[model samples]
Target: MKIKQGILFLITKSEVGGAQKYVREQIAICSKEFEVYLSTNEPGWLTEHVAGEIAGQLLDKRIESRTSIGYLTRLAKYIKEHGIGLVVTNSANAGMYGRIAAKMAGAASIYVSHGWSSVYNGGKLAFLLNRIERYLARLGDKVICVSAGDYEVARDKVGIAEDKLVLLKNCIFPVNATAAADRPAANGRLKLLSVARFAHPKRMDLLVAAMKGVTDAELYLVGGGKGEEEIRSYVHAQQLDNVHLLGEIKSFNGFGDYDAFVLISESEGLPMSGLEAMSAGMPLILSNVGGCKEIVVNESLLVNNTVEDIQRAIRALQHNYVQYKMPVKSFFDINFNLLVNQDKYLGLYRSLIK
Candidate 1:
């Protein structure tokens, strides 16, 4: 197992959300086997939240802090000067810059599609971006998809060739498994937790609306985003006493504070939060969308975006209508383990370099 010492470039728009977290984890792992150099607009809450040692290996390549031609030029210069062998871009904006920059710098470019970006949803701008992405796909040495669904969208909709695509599910260290297992259940009422940014795609509104129907359960909305004020206004206007907006929990171990986990997102790329919840042995109630269906295997309680469906899921979990073994450890072993999947990525990199 001779590890290569080639320079690797990791790019992301911002250190936020699942893509950011996934890139950070991969950077932490890859740094052990390669000289990993990271480039991003700025530090985000998610990047700051990771453990100190994992965060230390990341070398920030300062760009314009905004996704633009100026930033792309800066990234190109950095890649050339550093003799970067491989450029791995996480998410849409970074992918846009990294793909072109890697080509200019004579480095093998790898684009990691974390989810279907807003651009893929449909619009003149979205159409233009999708076209750009399609053209760029051919330039990339490899296009890594975070989920099977995302892979389909990249191939069928984005027009990326099948041979260029690869699936790499999101992975996280089950660091809190033991602590989460030790957490006591709610004595007075069941705690339902949703860990996501307060954004439209997350469909937190549906969960808030559904909570109106559940009198006995308490809902905790974690994470922050543009929709925070709107969510707060709805909570205050509705006067939902059972719902609590606890903001973002800075530590991964902080998840042990809850009983059950739920995510009502409209789309996802094998959400790590859900995996984290499962690792904690918490019963999960996820929206029947994207990789969520692949994760929530207990089909009996799968929820949808509709308020009625979410309400039904909450009620069902409350009444013991669904039962399934907690596959937390197995899930990690199957998907996230470095020994299981890192070698696959290493192989891909080596193949390209050869």
Candidate 2:
């Protein structure tokens, strides 16, 4: 006899980011136990990547960040017709619509918050969404946070119940890293790689500024977002040729040629790229914000998210990198192992619907 399995996942953007990959990896893991479905808008990286893997559906009617009334009805109808027992949402926008639709369809809802949208610096719309997100926290049967920091913020500031919030930290497995040409051990020029969206709070401009003084270092900024042009203009204006924007690269673990990985985002929820870098045996220089702090425990590698501080950290790290190398990767193994995390998530999935 075949056991029943019905789980649907909802995400807003299909671009390849930590949140998208988080949803992808979870769906991949959960598919082993149940039938999986994905509902996203448009044709994007996520749509192309997950094609034919499971049942695919598209949410056509939508606003800039929130689902529309028509889309919500369609989603609920899809859920009811498919007999979906669980509806899990990743990213803030997805949670908003997915939870409501799940309720209409009589299914359990789970919201995986990458980070609270309100924490970062954004204009008016972001502020409004941040305000509304707190109310939605109570809609989910469980609100899964990717970092302890996010979990705390949701519970303390967002007014989510202590019992409803769960800390399910992100994990990495090094076994699947791509093979990039290793940098020469001599290392006269330190090459740094940062994989993050070019958003306002990402602070790539600070990284470029830090490079101006560090004559012995170069940086490759990967990923894309609305702020890409401004960063490029700043880099060009500063004449910082040492800084290169690789745009959005398809491969996440392709940092084989760099000396270290860096992320200076104003906010995060335990970035997947940072953990992947650690799993790939790369050291990190990160801002001590959100999940980045949770990923790297050692305080030395953490910067104050400023130009002068980052510059000093870069110059200092270039000299004493050998000492900080082992501890970074070791932390990933201890705290973010793949199988260890899989069991934790699997347990949550089983218990939530029951």
Candidate 3:
């Protein structure tokens, strides 16, 4: 019998987010062909879900400090000791340290950028970080971009060679058709859902402000983050009784009663929340940034991440409810389906192997 090649998946955070979800889903598919191993900063939902599937060893790759010599040395040592052939790194910190460590250990590395946050976020720090990313791209065999917007930035702006970059969009597992088929009857109120971390780029604050004008709709915001208190305070101050905060949800199952799924952010890299909502046959009202445009049902659903625009978008969605629903489902099936992405991933992995 042919021995399965060893592959190490390194991600900086163990928290529940889009990047963590991508790592978890990749593990499930890659484990079927490779001897899978995982390393993270600490234990959380990502570690918990992957525990049973991985080979019985975990590496604490102390990844908090990007300049930590110990971080590089320890991770490199592990790769050499285990004879790991391929190292797949997720997130920015992990991408930097993990790629260098993989190179040091003589294993091929692929840096998967969830999003080029620094470049897209834009500020003084962005210039320096973008330079650093361009330099680091040389250490990895290839960089996988989750969105077309990211791909353009990585190549055109960051100046990474086209040969070293791969464009693979985000995807989700097949949702239950029967469950997703159920549409709540149109009551007097228009029910809208926005699932996102209340942080930079994700302007839940604007969504709250937008809610003031969207008097006829009930806005359900389902996420918790550093910006949660701020959002909650604003909601309280405005006395926006129509805005409901559902906190963090482990499973998106049974969240299918909304008229439209909304994510008003400054930027994104193919958000899993949007894809999940699309799978459930819900239309999207997203910011026209990153790859959000790729998943939107129509041009009208893409907003400018402003209070006025988001308010206008919500009203538009309410007016043309039936037109958006079927297209959202059909688009998910054709473009962002699980089976299509699985084939691309497995093929990419095989090609990278010597």
TM-score of each: 0.87, 0.91, 0.95
After superposition, the stretches of candidate 2 with alpha carbons farther than 4 Å from their true spots are 1-3, 61-67, 121-131, 178-187
Clash pairs (backbone) in predicted model 2: none
> Which 10-residue window in model 3 sums to the lowest lDDT?
177-186
lDDT by residue for model 1 (1-354), tens: 324435444555454566676776676666666656667666765445444523122334445344567667777787777656788887666777888888988889888876767444556677777787878889888888877878888878778789998887766766554424332254646678888988867888889989998888889988888998899999999999999998876544556777678898877778888877776667678887777766675765678689898888877777662244355447656866555667777677767752
Model 3, TM vs. native: 0.95
Candidate that scores best on lDDT: 3
Ranking the candidates on TM-score from highest down gives 3, 2, 1
* Lowest lDDT 10-residue stretch of candidate 1: 53-62
Q: Count clashing residue pairs per candidate.
A: 0, 0, 0
Better of 1 and 2 by lDDT: 2
Residue-by-residue lDDT tens digits, candidate 2, 230-346: 989998998888899899878555767677888897788888888878877777789989878777756778899788889877776677777666576567777897766688887
- Name model 3 segments beyond 4 Å from true: 1-3, 56-61, 176-184
